[model samples]
Target: MGNANQRTQLSEHIADILGTRDQPACGTSRLAIRKTIACGSMMMLALNPAQVGAVGLGEVELKSRLGQPLDATVPLTLREGESLPKNCVKPAPQNNSLARLSDLRVTAPARIGPGTYSVRISTTNPLHEPMYELSLMVKCPGATLLVRQYVLMLDLPGMPVE
Candidate 1:
């Protein structure tokens, strides 16, 4: 939502500048400015489509197990057909899913699990910032889902007293 607001503000600012700047003060100019800003906004959004939940306030949380791939869709949004750098893939005791950002479709680690793990993924891509870390919490596959369901149930009608 905040990103939407930011995009709106950016467009408005651009339009305001274009309207007031050295351009001709004519109706045709106004139409062109609006169209330009609109196209720019759309392009920006399209290029960032993979940035769904990637609100990188630093550490992103994930869950995984040994031999299972990590999920990297949170902290990193890669361009189409891009893969993680070699250094991004690490050995156990510090396993991660960031490596899966490429063709794995499963895009995390080739070998991981055992317990909670964390690893930082660095990127030189101008779209994503320099780097960010994923705090991977390891557990039985259904455990997290069960906990989530229990939490949702607790929030149901008259489930508990405040």
Candidate 2:
């Protein structure tokens, strides 16, 4: 019975991402999953273009715990010259400083391209979410640039990777 429940839970989680669990997938990132071989709530960035002010600048969908749309930002950390796609939109930025006392909701668009792109999502307290000193690395042809870090709390218990 326990095993069955686990399987059911897993299925539900997969279905939730696939949009069979609740609301249909909406927004560019979710919709583009079919176009790109690699697509999901999380993306890994690799390269960044020069003369770019912000990378991964846009809005992303965040479903409520019940699988409904809840405005949320897909926070990003970029290296110098590493920036998000332009025209991205999201909910107004929240002052995460007061996150402990209340739900600080925010949102940003998911970034797409040939560079490594990723957003931090987790449940740990906001203070531990790396609000500062977070930036993506851009592997240029001859040099690597670090874009300014823009932290957004999306996933619970955030996970870090290179």
Candidate 3:
């Protein structure tokens, strides 16, 4: 009984944070609140995988400057998916030798505590087009969600890589 009450309170707290409460449309507000609660539940579950169930959250897409160290913090409740990898994020093999990715890995906010995580990588050279593929994963129960982002590495003038 107490656990259920606590869960409800937590859901309400998360709903407030997500701005899903007190809307004009009651039906839509309920649905949005429900989704927010589910996301909050996922965050909690991800934080304590051993005690709860799954250990996955969501996905996000990011863009950065070319020839510079890429550091990005993406929210976990960005999208839903089906699979993930052993590591949260990894660099895919690049076909173009002129543009390459190095030192790719997950950095700070290692755990899924704040519904966000950070990734870092160093890109070298310039591509014909401003695009690079980055692989990301989130672990869930019995499955993992895999997301691929075509990061747009913008080429700015007077940049080191340019």
Tell me the deviation in Å of residue 22 in model 1.
15
TM-score of each: 0.22, 0.21, 0.37
* Model 1 lDDT at residue 57: 19
Residue-level lDDT for 144 in candidate 2: 37
Q: lDDT by residue for model 2 over 1-162, one digit each (tens)?
A: 999999999998777566445554465456445535454323434332343443432333332222222333344445554545432322233344432312332223344434434343223223333222222233333333333334434344334421
| lDDT pick, better of 2 and 3 | 3
Ranking by lDDT: 3, 2, 1
Better of 1 and 3 by lDDT: 3
Q: Please give, for residues 106-148, the per-residue lDDT of candidate 3 as tens digits.
A: 5433434343344444344333445555555543344444444
Q: Of the candidates shown, which would achieve the greatest TM-score relative to the real structure? A: 3
* lDDT of every predicted structure (CA atoms): 0.35, 0.39, 0.50
Worst 10 residues of 2 by lDDT: 63-72
Per-residue CA lDDT of model 1 for 45-101, tens digit only, reads 777543122111123343332233333322333233433332332212323333223
Decoy 3 TM-score against native: 0.37
Q: Candidate 1 — which residues are off by over 4 angstroms?
A: 1-24, 52-162
Positional deviation of residue 70's Cα in model 3 after best superposition, in angstroms: 2.9
